[model samples]
Target: MDWPTAAVVIVIAVCISLLIIAALAVVVGGKAAKGLKEFDKPTTRHTF
Candidate 1:
């Protein structure tokens, strides 16, 4: 394979990895939010 082909493969691999990570983050975050909701209250102002 040439340099360009190698670069394209690397880029595609990175994109796929990022997508998988994002998906896992969403799943874990939803579970965490549900678990924490019972201990927290909503505020009129953004506190983050």
Candidate 2:
């Protein structure tokens, strides 16, 4: 294979990997945010 062809293949592989990682990050982040929201209730404070 030519250098250009190899380079293009590598670039495509890198892009696809990046896209998969980004998608997983979004999914995990959304779940984490939802969990955090569940704990966002106001807490009572006592003054001494």
Candidate 3:
């Protein structure tokens, strides 16, 4: 593809990947917090 088309494709790919990553992070964040809470029952302020 041409430079402009390639640039657009790259940008789209990066955006899509970032969105997927964000979604995954959102999904995992809850579980991670729960795990941290269990791991450190005394104080969750620092880790959570």
Candidate 4:
């Protein structure tokens, strides 16, 4: 492969890997939020 072609392929691979990482983070964060919500206590907010 030419240098330009190789560079493009590398950039594409990096972008894909970044996307996968971001997706995993979102999934893990959601699970954590759900777990914490179960233990959340109800609170009443007074408005002036």
Task: For candidate 4, write residues 13-36 as lDDT tens digits.
Answer: 999999999999999999999866
- Residue-by-residue lDDT tens digits, candidate 2, 1-48: 999999999999999999999999999999999877766645422221
User: Which of the two, 1 or 3, has more TM-score?
Assistant: 1
Tens digits of per-residue lDDT, candidate 1, 1-48, equal 999999999999999999999999999999999767844656523464
* Clash list (residue pairs), candidate 1: none
* Candidate 4 runs further than 4 Å off: 41-48
- Look at candidate 1 and tell me the lDDT of residue 22: 100
Lowest lDDT 10-residue stretch of candidate 2: 39-48
| lDDT preference between candidates 3 and 4, better one | 3
Error of 2 at 9 (Å): 0.2
lDDT of every predicted structure (CA atoms): 0.87, 0.86, 0.89, 0.85
Query: Which should have the higher lDDT, number 2 or number 4?
Result: 2
Ranked by lDDT, top first: 3, 1, 2, 4
Global fold similarity of model 4 (TM-score) = 0.78
